[model samples]
Target: MLDNGNVVWDHSEPRRGANDGTSYLCHGHLARLREIVATTPKAVAWMREQLEPVKGDFEKTAPMKASSKLPISAAAVDAADETLGLLCSWAEYTAESIGQPAPDMSNTWKVLASADSTDGALRVQGMRSDGIATVDSVARWMLERIDVIATHEWVEDFTSELCDQRATNLARWPYEERPKPAKGIECPDCGHTTLVVFTPAFAPKYSTEPLLRNGKPVEVTETVNVYDRVINPGGSVSRSSRLVKRTKRYADGSPVLATVQRLNYAPPLLVQCRSSTCRAVVRESDWARMILQAG
Candidate 1:
């Protein structure tokens, strides 16, 4: 498993690559690489658009009823530029490592290839013999060669680096752009109203009952039952005996005749404190205790 909760492998079996003294990735990881390579170019394009000059007159000429666009600062542009540079560098490095043709340094590529200014006509590793190739084309080539690219560890590293860069760019935006938390809930640690609750969108419920077959209860075993004797005012009553059918036992010693599933109407929620001063969190395991304390 990786930091982003993506599991590269879940079985106990050793990989063939490892056995052969070389590294290899499972089919799933290759597919994941393909997905990342295929979608990253679009994200790069959007980030590039952020580098455009900000509109200066829109704010002043806008009507009072119209909503204004989010403010893009110099720092935001710098961050986007940095992310784009890193992506281009990674693409080039992958090409070099795999013995593929170095990416063609087109005008857009040259501008973003490095943070420093570059001459428009200067090309890196000479022009790609296959003609002009944009970042998207390079990415497509990578997708086609996904199987021979790198090991699982390399894939994980790639995923983390790109994801972290994207996260950094996103964090540059103001908190108002994110989901609005319930302000009425107070943070127990700071005594401030900054508790945010997140609940699972799809909560599952389960039920257990007697296991049935052909519309009848399937008896796993039988047990003998004895009726208790009762003492009368003048005489004693005799005890009675009978047999009782028993169902299979659950793992926890409970009887399970069958099973059913339903939606959990009241699912557990995670409570987090948004206060910078007191970054306390209450996980679902302790949610009940926290609620009791609050009450």
Candidate 2:
């Protein structure tokens, strides 16, 4: 168990086999435990590196001769405390997984709590050296366990099994869901031109009355002439003319009609009000499509 009350795996003993009154090794469980153990050394190294500069800063700012209290930055203290807390949690988790007793980590917790309690208190001393030593001791204890776990006969096999299991699990996981696209438009309530609305693809389609221009529905007409050759015993040519009608645009430039030019569908979108004081997300509704398309 780690000093933080985390139970670590005991590599010295052989595990019991299932329902046979025999002892055998479970490589899978050991592999998982080993993977966790492997990270401790790196974590300890990182904690040392992080604390070095903080320790230096404290030493420079702390009183040299007397036992006078020195002020430390809350940010620095919080950072150290967070690192320690993570280590503690890691230790506790490791211990719990292996069904072993965890160590008493009350001292480490006190160190973390002291940072908050010292705030607004009188005569708060900076125990930088003590904090560093405590971290160092914890790191050393973790290293010892790492050494023991590394000495297992199947450590290499455990590592390989862990890697395979991880790959298998990752392969089985589903891909992330894509986000809906955002549609921008003018807000009705705030009159903000930059209001954006999110339209989800699964949302039901909506209909709105066709927009008008000069109190009339906008339309367009096209005229085309086709020439045809006719050999009536003398080789002559005849021409014909025709007119085609298609909706183009309103006088205000809004599209009068939209054609299904492509079969591919677009993702849903979100639109938000861009007004600084009235930043609101437009709700998904039938009217939202009109606002998006019209704008």
Candidate 3:
């Protein structure tokens, strides 16, 4: 995957050659390759770089899963085939002009090393030998032809072989994008999980107040103030819970979360329920951006 989420087939061992390597239209060895491209395939670069934080974070434990693959359209295949045909014609014509026989289009050969591997044997499509007298010429021809073929593939899909096209600016979505609240927030008072919502009116508030204990008004500053916005932010969140005894044996603790007060102000939260209940809110760290309906 060249950052465009397109799968890259390995050709390190020269699996594909001009004379006897797998180039389809022959023994059908290219069938698997075609099928791989046809089916939704994952990115190879993604698989190789599963280390998360992605900067090779040695301290981090969980590595990221593989990135998704982009679909390769049949139109792309058709375009590649068409371009290959034209290149073959060009090579053949040049060969004929030089008084050498044009390489037979039907002629195919297999790479000896690839034959024994469970991986299908590598094969090559032939080019007229006249214009391609030297290996360097063939390499240059291949590079140019593949570039053209890859261009068509990119146009058919956003995945491009060219770095310039492949890394399209993370195109901004013209429409408004809003994040969604997590579902099933656990109630602090009743322990019931309920869906949560938030609005600008529900944003957190602050004021100096007296909290009464035993009918005596004691001046206590409550720095941590947040509302449970939604269910546990999917994964672990460094929370604590109280142990519940079940039939005097099997038991689990009721979940409890620590409120992180802001270093500058209070409640070091990115977003909190501004609602009165302030039931429970998620810190911005746990929030995710998603396409949401307008309020």
- The TM-scores of all predictions, comma-separated, are 0.36, 0.23, 0.17
State model 1's lDDT.
Answer: 0.51
Q: Residue-wise lDDT of candidate 3 within 92-148, one digit each (tens)?
A: 544544455554444322224455568776654332222112222322333223223
Q: Between prediction 2 and prediction 3, which has the larger TM-score? A: 2
What C-alpha lDDT, on a 0 to 100 scale, does residue 208 get in candidate 2? Answer: 52
**Best-to-worst ranking by lDDT:** 1, 2, 3
lDDT of prediction 3: 0.31
Model 1 quality (TM-score): 0.36
Q: What lDDT would candidate 2 get against the real structure? A: 0.42
Error of 2 at 52 (Å): 16
| Residue-level lDDT tens digits of model 2 in 96-125 | 655666544543443233445647544323
Pick out the ten consecutive residues of candidate 2 with the lowest summed lDDT: 16-25
For model 2 the TM-score comes to 0.23
Tens-digit per-residue lDDT, 1-295, candidate 1: 2332223342674333321223354443333344445544444434434533556687686564456555544564455455545656777777777777765545543222433546544334222222212544555455555545554357557756776776666565422223246555577678788866553322333455655689887645547575767776689677766667666676898664554444322222335566544545555557666666667
The models' CA-based lDDT, in order, is 0.51, 0.42, 0.31
Find the candidate with the highest lDDT and give its number: 1
